[model samples]
Target chain A: MIDVLTTAWNWIAEPLQYGFLRQAIWVSAFVGLVCAVLSCYVTLKGWSLMGDAVSHAVVPGVVISYALGIPFAVGAFAFGFGATVAIGYIKSKTRLKEDAVIGVVFTGFFAFGLVLVTKIPSNIDLFHILFGNVLGISRQDIIQTLIAGTLTLAVILLRRKDLLLFCFDPNHAKAIGLNTQMMYYTLLSVLALTIVTALQTAGIIMVVAMLVTPGATAYLLTDRFDRMLMISVAASVSACVLGTYFSYHFDVSTGGSIVVLLTVFFVLAMVFAPKYGLFAQRFRQRVYKKQLDEMSSPP
Target chain B: MTMTASSLDITVDDISVTYSNAKLALYNASCMVMPGTITALVGPNGSGKSTLFKSIMGFLQPSQGKIRVGGFPVQKVQKRQLMAYVPQSDEVDWNFPVSVFEVVMMGRYGYMNIFRTPRQKDRRIVMESLERVGLVDFRNHQIGELSGGQKKRAFLARALAQEGKVILLDEPFTGVDVKTEKRIIDLLLQLKQEGHTILVSTHDLASVSTFCDRTILLNQTILASGTTQEVFTEDNLTMAFGGLPISSLRQMTGQMTGQSSHIVNRQTSQNAEVEA
Candidate 1:
């Protein structure tokens, strides 16, 4: 036990201390919190697909920005925001279901990003786009991700009522004089930024899990938004810290490890959650039905 | 209120809404909604009744005309506190996790600050609204646990929580038990006594005879609109719902008091000023 404790203390160990792993772990912590928190609202709104859409869609923007030698964040932000608005616009203009449009646009844009990446030098590793690597973590990225994530979370947390109203009944919200359009677009923009920051640590491919899986799993276990958010954040942080440690020992990719951990948590929650979960709900139903039958039949 | 009939409330002037696909839902549709009165805006399934109601709230911007509350355009209406809207069930998800009291308190969100906590006044109002809807006992129950009628009553509680002068209820009676339906009607009358300007869109023409002060019948356009006893007639039924005229209809569909087949003028606007 003492040996294990000393080994853990060697997070200050020489070889582990010099490189990017520490920075990567810190950055992943923030990214996980941001994505996981925002995704509570997204999942509640049944717009969980938007996370994958925005994350995958940012690939083309990132590739294009790389080609232009510009900051990838700008391009990703622009395209992600554009796609979010386009989804809303298409729904308003035509009668197409919002999900259908999201599916179509997401696939098309993501494929374009893949093709754009191909057009660039083959030597540059684009695998980071599919599976994020924590090796390149820097001080700047950590600061940027932290500030943006904290601010986004604050804004969303503060406007909990308005945001919840918009998600549940947009028509009622509109009738009440809440600017649905402004709130709608503002949510999209924040989602876009959160996705971009998360992309740095989790990469485009694994980011969806970070965004949705924690929140979705939390939702299965809880009803109140506040509790769900807290659980999601807790789940995300646990995955980040544990996955980072596991990756260090097993010699695997950090983001992939975290996601695998999250998936395991999700599977457990799916079966064992106290209420609304598959197994528990079925068990409760049978018990309730039996009780009702007993009372009505009078033995 | 049992006060007066003709207090100016909602006025739609030359309102027109055309979808981006060039489907025109309403055109130059103009009417007035009087205070303390239940106006049944009736229409066929494909008609523009919903479009007109949505346009009135400024949810759907008019293609050409204007919608006003108390002679003031919708843009000039006060913030989210001014009006309450209850949408049909299809548009709402019953799976959401919220208690009955919490849902009703949602009506006060506009007045509540984002970071600020709910004050005692807000809680009292929410309790009172639930009492008005007769759901005080179920205040702590999760919304998902409520029956269909209880759900409608909960939505009413939310609307009452708004304490708005104007309320727009879309198909409130749909998918409810008959007993629940009458309970809703009684609740509406009570709200009417509270001086609420109520606009309800429904398929029930019988309400044209019983509660609604005026009925706006629309099949894309206003076919005929007037008081219950005035507008419920053979000729208008023939022209409006031609397949089932009032003469051929059973007692359930509607009834005609006498041989006067033409639509009654209702003189509704005239009675608007003095209900009692």
Candidate 2:
């Protein structure tokens, strides 16, 4: 047992000595934190599909940025915001529902990105943009992630109460003189920024998982937003650390492993959480039933 | 503490609301809510009652005309926190993860400066509001755990915490029990006595005659609006609820006659009745 433990320790610690691995871990952890925090609002507002839409829609922006030889964040944010506007415009212009509009717009952008990638002779790796290369991230990528993550966290914290009120009841928020329209766009901008920060760690395809899973798991565990935020952060950070360690030891894809670990956390929370978990709720119902039966029976 | 009451008069002038798809929800509707009175807006479902209220609250823009609150435009009065709105309980997400206390405290958001936390005074007002709605003991409870009636009271408490001179409530009596309904009526009466103007949109004609000083019957436009005794007649109700079964209309008119007579007897000393 000691030998196995020592071998595991060496496996994790040996990767910690490398600068790339250290950067990868830090970036992934920060991405996890920001994604988790924003996920609370995303889930509460039923904007999960919007997160997916924005993340996928960033693909064309990234391809176009590379084509123009500019930084990817600028292009990514523009396209993400553009996609949201397009969805809104289309929904308003036509009778199509919001979900249908989102599906059409994102798939179109994603296809356009694929065509652009194939037509361009640039060295931009479509694989890396889609699946991420966490272990291969450079110092610049790390700094970008750090800055975006910090800004997102600050804005969310500063406007937590207002944001919560807006999501819970937008009409009431507006009636009370809150700039609900501005807040709506601000939330979308933050989501775009958070997705941009996460791009390097989870890539486009899996970033939605990182954005949604941790908050959903925490939601199953708690009934309060503050506690839900704490639980989401803890869940995501731990998953990042553990997944990074295991991916280093096992030589697997870091992003894939991290998402797998997040899924595991979600499943556990769904089954075992005290109040809202499946088993716990059934257990309480059974106990109540037994008490009722006893009360109805002759003594 | 003594409640500082200020009467606010609302004048909705020739307001017309059209949806993005060009559906005319409200067509050149107009009404006047006098200060220090409770006016009930009664209509069938989709009769533009909610649309009118939304336009008044500045949530929905009117394609034509304007709304004025206390001599200021609706938009300006909203910024000054002179109006409070209690939306129907169904409009809110009950599963939202917030405490009853926090929801009530949201009413003070307009009064707060950006980046500032709630102070002692805000907290005291929230607590007082909760006490008024009889939800003081449920301050720490999650909002979703409350019964439907409790949820309505919780929103009422939020409106009370706003301390606005004008309150607009949309369907507060729906899905609530008798006790909660009574409590709400008592609170509205108290607020009216304290010199606040209130407009409630409801489908309950019985409660309209019972509690409201005036009634507005609407069907995409104002069918009739005046003192309860003057406007709640069978013909006006028939105009508002078109195509109603004759038997039910007869029963409804019978009930309206009984209530209108009671209102006439009660308002004999006052000359507040008006025809529309």
Candidate 3:
């Protein structure tokens, strides 16, 4: 047992000495933080699929930016924002439901991106864009991630109350003289920015998991938004750090490891969370039933 | 408290609204609500009561004509923070993880500068609103955990916290218990006494004569609107309900009698005795 503990300690301690591992850790941590914070709004607004749609829709943008020889962030953000607007426009203009519009638009964007990848002969790394290359990030990538993460996090924190009210009840928000249209677009923009920041660490597919899982897990564990935020950040940061370490030790995909850890956390919270957990609720129900039986059959 | 000059006197002039699918919701609806009175908007299920309120609240754009509040256009009045709307409780997502306090504090968002947090004044107002609605003890409770009546009261508390000169409520009495209904009536009377203009949409005709100083009977248009004694007659009700069954009319008359019995006791009761 001591030997196993010693090896585990060394495994975590040795990664601290490497610059690349350190960069990967910090980058993933930042991505996790922003994604988790924004995830609360996304989940509360019932926009989980919207987050998926925007993330997937960025592939063509990334590919186009590479072809244009511009920065990937610019193209990714443009496409992310464009996808959200398109979704909103389609939802508003037609009778189609929001999820259907999102599905059609994102699938079209993803297919277009795949076709572009096949057509282009550039040296753009399709695999890394699709699944991420967190361990291989450079110093410039760290700076970009830092800037994006900080801006997104700050905006979310600053507008947390307004955003919460807007998501919870938009009509009330508008009735109270809030420009709900502005709030809507602001949330969409934040979502796009968060997705863009997370693109490098979790990539398109896994980024949605990072954006959704932490908030969902925290939701199961708490009834208050403030506590939900704290728990989501803690859960996401721990998953990012531990998953990075695990991936390094096992030679697995870092994004995959992080997503797996997030899923584990969600499952645990679902089963064991104090109030809303499955077992806790069932246990309460049984106790109540017992009390009812006692009351009904009293001497 | 002195009545502000901005206490809104709502005026809907020849306004009409059509849904996107081309269904006419309201047709040249017109009414006037004087300041410092609780006006009940009475109509059947699809009589455009909510549509009129929405248009007046600037939620719907009327296809024709205009709506003015406090001598200003609805939009301008809204921008000036002179109006508050409380939609049906069912329209809200109760499962949202907001506390009763947070939900009520949202009322102060209109008066708050963007990017500014709620101050001590805002907190005190929220607390007072909660106390008025009798939910101060439940301030920290999750909104979803509240009973249905409590949810309605919470929204009422939110509207009170807005401190608007004009308040529009969409069916505040629906689905609430008797105690909550009475509390809302008492609160409406208090607000009216405080010089706040209140327009409430309701199907409860009994409470209309008891509480509302004025009532607007609508059926795709204003059939009758004046003091409850003038507008809430059986004739106007029959027009609003598209020939409401005589049985329902008798029940309404029974309620107007203030008798504890639920049976339809009289069809020829004096209208003067029924008028509040």
Candidate 4:
């Protein structure tokens, strides 16, 4: 057991000396951090389904970009953003329900991606875009993640009020002459950009888990928006570092390891955090019921 | 668009609204809100009070004539600095993760440049508006923590931050406790004193006479509108509620017996009078 552990340690420690591995670690950390921040509002707004929808909707763009050998992120962004805008437009102009719109657009995109994947079956990197390759993370991917993360932060900080109003009391925002359409698209675009940055290191499936779990876990800890974002980032960064380390030592898929790491953190938060955590919530309800019985019976 | 028409009044003339569901919610609604007064719009359920309020607030464009706010046509009066709206409820996602102060600061959106953040003056206005609503301590509290009444006050604070010449409220008192209701009414009265034109939709007939300067009674259309005393007459009340009176069906035939418009059952007519 000691020999096996030492071997595992040597394999992981060796990668630290290489620039490529360093870039992979940096990229994952940035993606995790940005996603954690953005997820605060997303979770609060009960749009927890957002990461699932937005990430899946980027499928067709990934297929097209790969087919044409173009910058995949560009195609993915435009298509992701286009799909988001289309859903928003349909929601605005038609009386159709939002969930129906999301389902139709997202499924259609996923199907298109699947078809592309089938066509490229024999390739070693065939489904790499979906599962990701954190082990093979590149310098260009790191730059891409960094730039998108920075831009996402900048936009959120700058238009904090407009975005807050748009999310909270949209009718009042409209009545006061805020262009609802413009604000809607601006948020969708930011969502698209955030997804694109996350697509590289964590990829589609695990990236979504990373995006949602940390924020949800953090939500168990605080009720303030700014603090929620901060805690989410902290949770995500911690998960990313731990997951990367474990992936290296265990000789497993980094993407899968990262998702597992995040899920564990979320479970811990659910059971342990104060007040609204899952276990605490149930326990509190029991105590409150007991107190009510004591007060009401013959009193 | 700003309502710079040298008057602070709203006038809806020959306006009609039909819902997308093909129901004519309003039929030729018309009224005038004079300057510097609180005009209470009252009616029974399904009445066009909310419809009229929506038309005046430019939320609904009428199919017929126009509704002007402060002499500025509804289409042209889309200026944030001159007009603000208070909804009955903040039904938007409470999970939106905004503090009360952040929500109120959004009132300055129109005055801001496309990429601009809130100015110091704008922040000050938001702070004062929060203070006005007695939610200064809750400025940094997440919206999810607020009770229903506090939620309404937060919205009102957002409107107050607009510093508008006019405020249009839609059933603003719903779900609010009586103490909070009175505080809101007091705040509206204060707004009136500041020369703001206030129009509010209400279902409470009892409170109209006490606080409102005038009342517009509507039932799918304008039934009667004028001072509270002028509009709440028995004749208008009958028309506003409906033509049939329950007393006509009551066990009393008393004096309404033989000289009535139609005949009653001969056997029950005498008993009805006795039971009267």
Candidate 5:
């Protein structure tokens, strides 16, 4: 047992010998924390598809940023915000539902991005942007991630009460003199920025998972919003670390590994969570049925 | 404590709301709710009750008319934290993971600091509001865990915490039990006696005369607006609830006879479905 434990320790510790791997782990963990925080809002607001749409819509911005010799985050945020606005506009103009509008807008943006990537001879790799290259993250990218992540986290936590009310009951928010329209736009902006922060770690494709799975996992685990936020952050950060560790040792895609770990956590919560899990729901139903049976048979 | 007894009369004047889709929800609809009175805004489904409430709350912009509270525009009154609103249950995401206390505390947000960190006084007021609504025992419970009536009371507690003199409730009794409905009506009466102005939209006509001092009959426009004894007549009710069975309308106007009460109750349930 001691030999096996030592071997495992070596497998984990040996990767830390490389500075890039250490940076990758920390950066991905930071990205996970931001995504997890916003994920609580995303999942609670039923904006998982919105997250998916915004993340996919960032691709065109990234390709354009590379072409323009500018930072990708600026381009990514512009495209993400633009897509959100477009979705809202189309939904309002036509009788189409929001989901349908989001679907059409995101795919259009993503396809446009694909065309740009192929048409322009650029140094940017579509594979890296689509699936991420956290292991090869640049120092500049790390700094950008930290700044954007910190801003997003601060805004969410500071305005949590109003945002919570807006998501839970928008009419009440408006009645209380809150500008619900501003809150809506602010949340969308935050979502776009969060996607940008997670872009380097999870890429455009799996970033939605980073923004959705953690919040959903926490949702099943708790019935309180504050605890839900804390649980999602804790679970997501750990998943980031563990997934990065495994990715390094197994030579696997880091984004894919992190998303897989997040899914595993969600599945675990869905099955075994104390309050809202599938098994717990089934158990409560059985208990109620048993009590009904006893009452019918006796009294 | 920002709890002032200063009440304001809500004056909705010829407000017409046309949605972007060109659906005219309310046209030239007007009513006045005096301070220290509970006014019932009675109408059938899609008769612009919700639209009128939204206009008063400054949520939907009126394409033509104006709404003023205490001679001030609705927006000004809202900015003063003198207006509180309780939306219909369908308008809220009940499954949200919020504690009963937190939900009530939302009422104090306008009085709170930018970060919305509740002060000790805010907490005390929230506790008092909960006690007033008989929900103190369930303060820590998840809001979704409550019964339909309890959920309605929780939102009422929130409005109480706001210390608003003018309160607007949209269908507060739709899904609630009779006991809870009585409790809510009693609470509203108590608030009214304390000089608060309340405008409630509901399909439950059987109890309007029991509590409401004034009634506004509306069908896209105000059919009648006056004392409950005058405005809640059979003719006005027929104009508002145009397609409802005459028996149900008669029950509403004929002092809620026991048999008619049953029919009204059934009609109330049907209206809940239609509204949803």
Candidate 6:
């Protein structure tokens, strides 16, 4: 037992010797926390598809930023924000529903990004941009991610109550003079920034999972928004830390490992949650049915 | 608790609203609600009742004309916290993870500081509002756990906590039990006695004459407006309901009245008194 324990400890401690691995772990945890916090709002507001659309839509912006020798986040945020605006504009202008508009706009932007990737010089690594390279992330990219993530976190925390009211009932929010339009734009902008923040850690293809899975898992476990927020942060941060360790040992993708863990947690919560889970619902129904049978038996 | 009487009245002057899709919702709609009175805005399903409410609350900008509260512009009145609105049940997400207490606490948002941290007074008022709606026991329960009537009562508690001089409720009685309906009517009457101006939009015509001091029959525009006794006539109701005869209208009210023995007795007594 002592030998096994020592081996496990060595496996954990050996990675800390490398500066890049240490930075990767810290960056992963930070990105997980920021995405998890915003995920609560995204899940509750029924904006999961919006998160997906915005994340995928940032690919062209990253390519453009690479071509122009500028910061990737600035260009990525612009396109992400622009995608949301275009979706809104088109939905208002045409008779199409929001989901259809989101589908068309995101696909068009992603296809345009693919074409740009093919035509650009080979200096840019398309694989890293699509699937993330957190283990090999640079110091500058880390700083950019942290700054964007912190700003998004601050705005969400400061305006938490009004945003909650807006998501729950926009009409009532307006009735209370809370400026629902401003709240709408604030939420959309922060969502765009959050996508940009997660881009370096989770990449465009996997970032939507980072933005949606934790909150969905937390939602199943609790019936209070405050508790839900805390649970999501805890779940996501732990997933990031553990998934990075596992990925290092197994030589696998870090973002993929973390998202897989998040999905597993969501499934566990869905099946076994105390109050609203599938098992609990079935258990309640069975008990009620037994009582009915007993009563019908001439008691 | 005695509420200070409000002397403010609501006036909508020839307001017209057109949606972004070029759908004209309301055209030249106008009405006046007096303070210290309960006025009913009666209309059909697609008759722009909600659009009118939105215009009055300044949620939708009217293409022409204006709305004023106590001789002040709608925007200025809103800034002064002079209005509270209760939208229909379908307008909210029931599955949101907010407690009944938290939902009612939202009414005090206008009174909170920048952080929206509730003061002791806000907590006390939230409790009092819950008590008023008889949902104090369910304060900590998630809103989705509540029954249909309980949900309506919770929203009513929120409106009560708002402490706005002018209250507009759209379809407050729909999907509620008779007991809850009685509770709502009683609360509205109490607010009327306190000199608050109330505008309630509902298709439930039976109860309009039971308590409302004035009624505005609406079908795209004001079909009739005056005291309930004058405007709630069979002809005006027929026109407003799109040619439903007086017999079916009475039957609708009668079927609704038959749901509760208490309301039936009171309605019969009131009808006998009217006949006498």
- Top candidate by DockQ: 2
In candidate 5, what are the lDDT values of residues B1-276, reduced to their tens digit?
233556789888778899878899988776788777899998899889998988899888899999999889977877788889998888787779999999999999988887899999999999999999999999999998999999999999999999988899999998888899999999888888788889999888888888998877788887777766666545556667878877877765566433333344312322121110
Instruction: Indicate the residue-level lDDT of A225 in model 1.
Output: 71
Q: By the DockQ metric, which is better: model 2 or model 4?
A: 2
DockQ of candidate 6 (2 decimals): 0.57
Clashing pairs in 2: none
Docking class of 5: medium
- Write one digit per residue (lDDT tens) for candidate 2, span B64-160: 9989999999778878888999988778887788999989998888888886488899999999999988999999999999998899889888988
Docking class of 2: medium
Q: What is the TM-score of chain B in candidate 2?
A: 0.91
Query: Mind listing the fnat for each candidate?
Result: 0.63, 0.70, 0.53, 0.55, 0.80, 0.63
Model 3, position A91, has a per-residue lDDT of: 83
Could you give the interface RMSD of each candidate, to one decimal?
A: 2.6, 1.3, 1.7, 3.2, 1.3, 1.4
Ten contiguous residues with the weakest lDDT in model 3 chain B: B267-276
* Winner on DockQ (1 vs 4): 1
Segments in model 4 whose C-alpha atoms lie over 4 Å from true places: A1-14, A92-95, A117-126, A282-299, B1-7, B13-28, B46-55, B58-66, B73-80, B90-96, B108-127, B135-148, B234-276
- Predictions ranked by DockQ, top down? 2, 5, 6, 3, 1, 4
Chain B TM-score in each of the candidates: 0.88, 0.91, 0.89, 0.83, 0.90, 0.89
* Per-residue lDDT over B133-213 for candidate 4, one digit per residue giving the tens place of the 0 to 100 score: 999998988877899889889988988888788888888888889989899999988888778888888876656666898
Per-residue accuracy of model 3 over A191-255 as CA lDDT, tens digit each: 98898898888989999999899999999998899899999999999999999999999989999
Model 3 Cα lDDT, one tens digit per residue, B163-267? 888888899888888888898889889888888999999988877878898878787887777776666555556566866685677587554433322322113
**lDDT, model 6, position B98:** 99
Per-prediction tally of clashes? 9, 0, 0, 1, 0, 0
Q: Show pairs that collide, candidate 4.
A: A44-B95
Q: Report the lDDT of model 1 for residue A185.
A: 84
Candidate 5 ranges with C-alpha deviation above 4 Å: B1-6, B256-276
Worst 10 residues of 2 chain A by lDDT: A138-147
